[model samples]
Structure formats: structure tokens, C-alpha cells
Target: MKISILTSLLILLSLAAQTSPVLKIKFDDIESGNIFLINVQKELTDTLSINNGKVTYEAKIAAPTFFYLIVDGYNNTRPLELVLSSQLTEMKFESYKVVGENTVNEAYPNSPIFISDPNNNIAFFEFLSHWKSFYNTIQALSENDSEEQLEKRKNTYHTFLSTNKQIIENNSDQYVSAKMIDFLLNNNLLQFETLQTYYDLLSPKVKESYLGFKIGEKSGKAGQLQPGKPAPEIALVDIQGKKYSLQSLKGKNVILHFWSSSCAPCIKEAPDLLKLQQGNTENLVVINFSLDTDNSKWKKGIERAGIEEMINVCDLQGYNSVTAKSYDVTFIPVYYLIDANGNISLKGTLSQITEKIKEDMP
Candidate 1:
């Protein structure tokens, strides 16, 4: 009986994996298909809201979609409903409020469009188009991957980000588009590349905002760092009472990794990193920064992931670290590999290029 029940459970799990999810949200004035957070009491789960009433998700969305949503962000308050028919799948979004109101109030800057809804349109659709393309590319790379699938994902993501960079003029808004562009270069280019006239296009205020800024101070001007520039430095306290300087490791190769207890990917990558470290102790030094402000969670993550020997470090400032600001890091489980000379050697998805490091370092 026990063996049979275990087998049955496995079968059920497999079936769940194969199923595409359909959701019904009984909220009004929210017809958008933009993904959002689902609140069961106070905690959050993966959910998408209808930006316009009649829309279909058809696939899963990025996790940051949920973060922005939990903070009551992403989609503006618009009415939404589900439309299902026997023969086809489709969506329809309608406008709400007056014409001036039709455009998102300048207050609702993060609001998505109601598709054909007028009055709120900007000339920035090119940026929007590329961002959606990049996000979808990332969404497709979810754990189900064979060798062929992996190649296709990386190539597709690289090309999408590369082509899309042209549409982004400068660091004007430093929102989602800017984040996407940085992710692309850090992951694909390994360093920021300059396009002609990019600096000229940006005003002096945008370029000089970081001179005396605090760690968490954000503006509309975050972009990739220039060549030979020192990586962003930080003063952080570890599990011990000792404080450390991020810039002190000027003459060494440093692997700046960010993680938290809540992330499964962060957990999975820990062992791989330890093994990598043991093998490359001569050139590789890891400075892991945790986003978890909760010390219990931070300690639990370190214990559970078995990274005790790793120079596990954090400022306990969560998102307000000077390094995070300098690099504009928006997500966890990311790392920046700086060369011995203090220039950014590699950036972007760490797992994507682990083998490259293994080959070079070994």
C-alpha cells in the first residue's frame, strides 16, 4: 500500500507539471493581462491580473512581476474579467476614466497600457517591445532544459537584448528597460560597451548623480559602469562583528554574489559554487552579499546551503547596499566577477557562464 501511494504521488506531480494554469480574478477595473501578485491573507504567491477585463496569460511570468505587484505596483487600477469560448483564446481591454485620466496619471508611472487605450501612449514603445521580448525570453528558460533548449535560450536572449539596446536612447528613466539592458551586458557582454553619442545624449545631471550619493539613493540614471572603473565598494558586517571593505580587495579577483534564504536557485547554486571555489582558490575570491535583512533567514540559508567556509558577507541593509546601487542589481542569485585589475570581468547570470570559468580557472 505504501509503495503504491508513493508511485501515485509521483504520477500526480508529473501531471501537475504538464498542466497549463488558468486563473479567474473577480476584481473590477483591472482588465490587464500584466502579471501581478496574489494575496492569500498577507503573504504573496505567483499571480497575474487582468490589465484589461478580457485577457489570457497563456504562460508564467517573471518573479519581479510579483515583487512589484506585492508593493501594489505594475498594473494601474483598471477593470478586468475573463473571457473563455469553446473555439478560441483571446483578450479584450477597454478604457476607463476621462481622457486626461485615460492616460495614466503621472503618478501611475509603472502602469501598463490597456492595449488600444489612448491618452496614455508614449513614444517609448520600442523600449517596451524589447523589454517584453527579453522577459519572455527569460521566462522560456525556466528549469525545463535539454542541451538544445539551453543553447536556444542563451542565443535568443543575447540577440534580443543586443538588438533592443539600440531602441533605448540613454539612462533617462532607469526603470525596467535600464535593468534589462544591464542584465544583458553583465550576462552576455561581461562589461558595458559604449555606443556612439550615448554620453552626449545624457544630460550632466544624469551622469553626475552618483558623486556623493548614499547607498540606497536611486535616481533615473542607473546604467552599466565604464571600462577600468572600480566596481562599487561596500562596508559590510559579516556573521561575526567584523566589518569589511569591498574596495579593499583591489588587487584580487572577486566574485560578488547576492542571495537569500527564500531562493531555491540560490540554494542549488551554493554547492556548485563551493566546489568551484575549492578548485580555483588561487584566482577566485567570493564576497557573497545577502539581501535578507532577517538574520535568522540569513543564518539558516548559510547553514542549509552548506557554504560555511565561503566568506559569506552582508551589510544587512538589504536593498540599500552601496554595491547594489553602484551595480543596479535588482534580483537575487546574481554575481559580478571582477578581474584582478578591478574591472568587471563577467556579469549576468552566473550559472550561464560557470563552465566558462571552470575551463579558464582550471
Candidate 2:
């Protein structure tokens, strides 16, 4: 009797497991097509063909899972995104131009278009909208703005940062907090004290998650080489076996260019830097720091690119170079323009540096 009862219980449990929730996604006016769902975390792609403009899938998810809904043969363009297991998430796609578009276009029917669980990702979607609006506002600012205008823009950015921080704090337990925290930390927008407090407020589970760990890594590196901050000292040997230091380039406008031989963009921007240095020979100096472990490749690249006009140096440590760490160098081809007083005046792309030089130096 005991064995029979145990077997009956196992059968019931199996049935219960099979009855896990089904996430139904119905697309209206999806003409003769297959929609694919790309799992964000697992890197798995699953497909569902639209039958009478409806497609249903089983979602046995405990944690919030993100899926990119891409229409097949449309350059893998994601028209809709689903953050699952929040609520009864449903999406409706209509009037899509999917044919003959070679490039992956931004998906339309933009957000607050929630699917699955509403509570899980509503904050995240809202944050995205706020960030987008803020970005557009910044982009609209005039490039030839005066010091007062620049200060105003800076103040506006800080205001947005404060607002975003509050949003993250309010939704500390949600996945959106982890993402926002990571972005803020990496962008050098968050204060160290605030970061510590935010981390403390996060639940133990969130603090231990993958996204949380990434946020922790970025938070540890705040206030490294922010604009208007004094450029940090960097001591490294040039390719020609000569030592170079940041202090040595004082009393001249310096470009602290961090790059690598393998970086295509870095190599491509070599000519532009050459032109900038040649054009402003009286006041400018480009200190090119190569983050290359292979000495031979570094030498060859420099010679081939004809970038020997500037001061080039490498410690042969690649990404682990102490100099790179001091400046918080994550991406190569990063340009930090320093004024005669050794304060970082600008930090951005080659074009941005050129624009700044024209505006300020000229």
C-alpha cells in the first residue's frame, strides 16, 4: 500500500510539472511568416509560425527571461522584445515592412508594449524611454556652445543621472536596477557613496546575480579620469626603448590616445591623428599608447601605418597594463585630450576630438 501510494504521488507530480504556464503571443496581420524568439541569456533561438495570426509557447521560467522576437528573412530584425514570466505577456505585430531590407532595422511598435509579466520589466522599459529622451536632448545641443551652455548641459546630464539612480533604488529588487547600475557605473556618472548605498540596498539574490557582479566591477572604478579632472601620471617605455611620462608633455596640448595594433579603428584613425598633429604642430602633441602584448606586431603596425610622427609607447602588458588601468581604458581607440595645464579637456572619438580642437584651440 505504501509503494502504490508513492507511485500515485509521482504520477501526479509529473502531471503538475507538465501543466506549467503557456505564454501565448498573438500577432495580428502577420502575413504568411515565421517569427523567431532569440533567448537573451541562453543564446538559443526558437521559432513559431503564425497560424491565423497566433503563436503560443510554453514558458517554464522562474526568473525573468528576455527574448528578441525577429521576423525571418527580414535581416533578423527584432520587431518586438519580450521579458518573460512577469504576467500574461502578449504582443501584437502589424504593418511590418520585412522584405528587401538588407540592414537590421530598429524594431517598431515601441515599448511600454509589455509581454509576459508586467511587473518584472515595466521599470526597465520606462528607464529605457527616459534614457532615449535624454540622449536626444543632448544630441540636439549646439556643438559650438559657449562655456555657460556646456555647464548647463553638464548639469542636465547630472540631473538625469540622479533621476535614474532613484528609479534604480525604487526598483532595487527588479532586474532593471542591475542593468541601470551597471550603465551608470561604467559611464562614470554615479557617485561612490551612492553606489555603495545602492549596492547595500540590493537584495542578497540580486547582489549575487551575474548582472550584479558586473555592476560591482564597474562601481569599483568610478572617478578615474573624468573630464575637468587632472590627467593621471603614466610611465611606460616607447617602442624605441625610450621611457615616456605624462608630466614630460606638460605645457602643450596632449592627446592621450590608448589603442592596439589589432584594432582596425585605431589603425584607421592613424592618418587623422597624423593630420591633426601636422596641422597643429605648434601647440599639440599626440601620445599614442599601444596596448599590445606582441612587440613585433606593434612595431610592424606602426611602421606600416606610418604613425611614427607621434610618441608611441607600450608596456607589452596589453589590457593588463598599469597605465591603461589608471585611465580606466575599457575600449581601444579612446582619445583623451589634455590642455596645457594637464587637465582632461575632452574625451571621445577622433571626430569629437577634432571638433573640440577646432572650437577651443582654434
Candidate 3:
């Protein structure tokens, strides 16, 4: 009887150890709504129903992973980003308010107050706060062109970099270190060399994390793209499922525009792009390479922009698309001008591309 009881206790302990992590969220100001949890690594979204301003969610994550939480019908509120590990995590939102009198309502306090953070979320938030302070200071200094202000800005910038480097190094083993590196790189906040140094400081286990691998992959491929280098071959299907390739468009100057439907800047420049294409229809082929994953949105964006004349194509892989990786497309609205010889001639923003076209094509 004693042996049987001991065996049963062992089994129960094993089962408890294998249980998935749970996320508990409490919003004092919100009630009877749905909270969407987006798992960044898995690219999956789960809806958690709020009952009495509280909800509990279970996540099947083995390591520290990034998640975004957004309230339904709250388009104005930025998604709350947090890192979750294989442990119980809790968040609390004390206050919120609906803004604007329009049909669409915006919400405030997108970030949540941590009730219990077993992971490195607290550290990540601290880092974000520091970065934001530094960013605002630099922006304010930019408005003052005095020599003293300029020197102050330079010193402040270097100080920010040094402080961030120290923070990352101190938390090298934490998952938040990798998250900080990713945030800095994605926002173009840090120089490539500094980013590489920070990346190298990550612990072996953190380096093997999902975000870490993605950063390394992007950095490794960054040097492959430049002027005079052969443009990477792009073989992707258009909206109509017709296959297209850069090889097929040889002997013509190609403007490879990387964009996405959700990107406001890309949409804003649509009419200008259409005009450019219309004016130079003889020898120029403008290919709109979209990074949107949703098929309906991609088509709707094209229709709304009235740029059907341009070669609109998408692999529907978003940032994970092979073509985007080859071109080192970190952000959207990136324009690449490839010459008739199939070599990259220039790459820049829309205005710069326009200048290049006017100088070379005219």
C-alpha cells in the first residue's frame, strides 16, 4: 500500500510538470469583451473571452516567446507586447479610455501593468522606457541647431548607445536581451556594428531562441545586397497565380518596389508610383512586390490604389518571404532600381528613386 501511494504521487508530479503555461489577464476598466493574443513566433492568434474583466489563457510555448495583446474594436490602441515563458504570467490594466467621436474608437494605455512576470518582461519594459527617453531627448535636441545643442545631441547619442550596450550585456542570458536587440534593429536605432556586437553578447541558449535566429539570419544576409551586385532572382506568383521572375523581365529597367497593404507609407505613394509607371511605359517595368499575407487584403489594396497596370505580385509570406530576405527588406516602401543588365543600379526611398529615374531615364 505504501509503495502504491508513492508511485501515484510521482505520477501526479510528472503530470504537473508537463502542464502548459497559463497567462492570466485582469482589466479593471474593461468588461465583457474579447482580448486577442497574438503569438509572434508561431504566427497564431487566439481569442480569450473576458468575463467580469478577467481572463485566463494557456500557451504552448517551450521557451520565452513574444506575444501581442489587443482588445477587440480597439483599433487605436497599440498592441501590448510581452514576453512569455513556460511559467505563469499575469497582467493588469487599471485604466483605459475611448477617444475620438468617430465611428471607430481608439483606446489608450496599450501597455499593461505587470501583476506577475515570471519571464524577462519587466526587464524588457525597463529597456523600452530608457530607449524612449533617449529618443525623445534626441528629437528635442534636433530642433535646436545651436552649436551647443549639436554637441549635446552627439554626446547624448553616444551615451544612449553605451548605456544600452551595458544593459544588454548585463542581461545577456535573459530572453529580453534578444528582444531589445530585435527592437533596436527593426527601428534602425542602432548601427550595424553595434547591433552585431550586442547580438554576439547573447547567451548560447538565447542565441538559439526564435528572435535571435531571425536577427542573425537577417544580419548574415545584409551584406549580400548593394549597388553593382546582381539582383537576386525573384520567382513569385502574382495575385492571379501567374508565376513571374526577374529573369523574364530582362532587357528592361525594373523598379522593384517592396511594400505591404497595411503599410500606410506604401499606400500613400501609390498614386505617385502609378504616374511614374504611366509616364515611362516603354522601357520601365515597375514590379510591386507585396509582403502581405492575406490574399483578400492584397487584392483590395491594389484595387484601392488603382495600380493594376504595375506588375503586382506577392508570395503571401510577409516578412518570412524568400524574396524579401534576399533583398534585405526590413521595412516596407523600399524601392530598388535594377538596370537592363540585371544588376542593381540603385536603391532608396520613393523620392530618391524618382530622382534616379529622371536623371537616368530622361
Which residue window of length 10 is worst by lDDT in model 2? Answer: 101-110
Give candidate 3 misplaced runs (Cα > 4 Å): 1-21, 74-77, 97-111, 144-149, 221-325, 329-362
Indicate whether candidate 2 or candidate 3 has the larger TM-score. 3
Which pairs of residues collide in candidate 2? 86-117, 87-116, 87-117, 89-115, 89-116
Give lDDT: candidate 3, residue 54: 89
Clash totals for all candidate models: 20, 5, 0
Tens digit per residue, CA lDDT, model 2, 83-137? 5653466555455555444322222333433354554566766666666666666
The order by descending TM-score is: 3, 2, 1
Error of 2 at 330 (Å): 5.5
Q: How far is candidate 3 from the true structure (C-alpha RMSD, Å)?
A: 11.0
lDDT of 1 by residue, 1-362 (tens): 25688899999888656524333322245544445545322344455545445434343321112122321332334322111112122222233332233532223233333333111123234445555566666666766756676677768756864665555454333322333333343343222213222333333443442321211122212344433566666676667766666466666677878787756667888988888787778777887788788888888889989998888876666767676767765556676777677776666456644755766565
lDDT of 1 at 264: 61
Using lDDT as the yardstick, the better of models 1 and 2 is 2
In order of appearance, the predictions have TM-scores of: 0.43, 0.54, 0.56
Candidate 2 stretches greater than 4 Å from native: 1-19, 73-81, 86-88, 93-108, 115-118, 182-201, 221-362
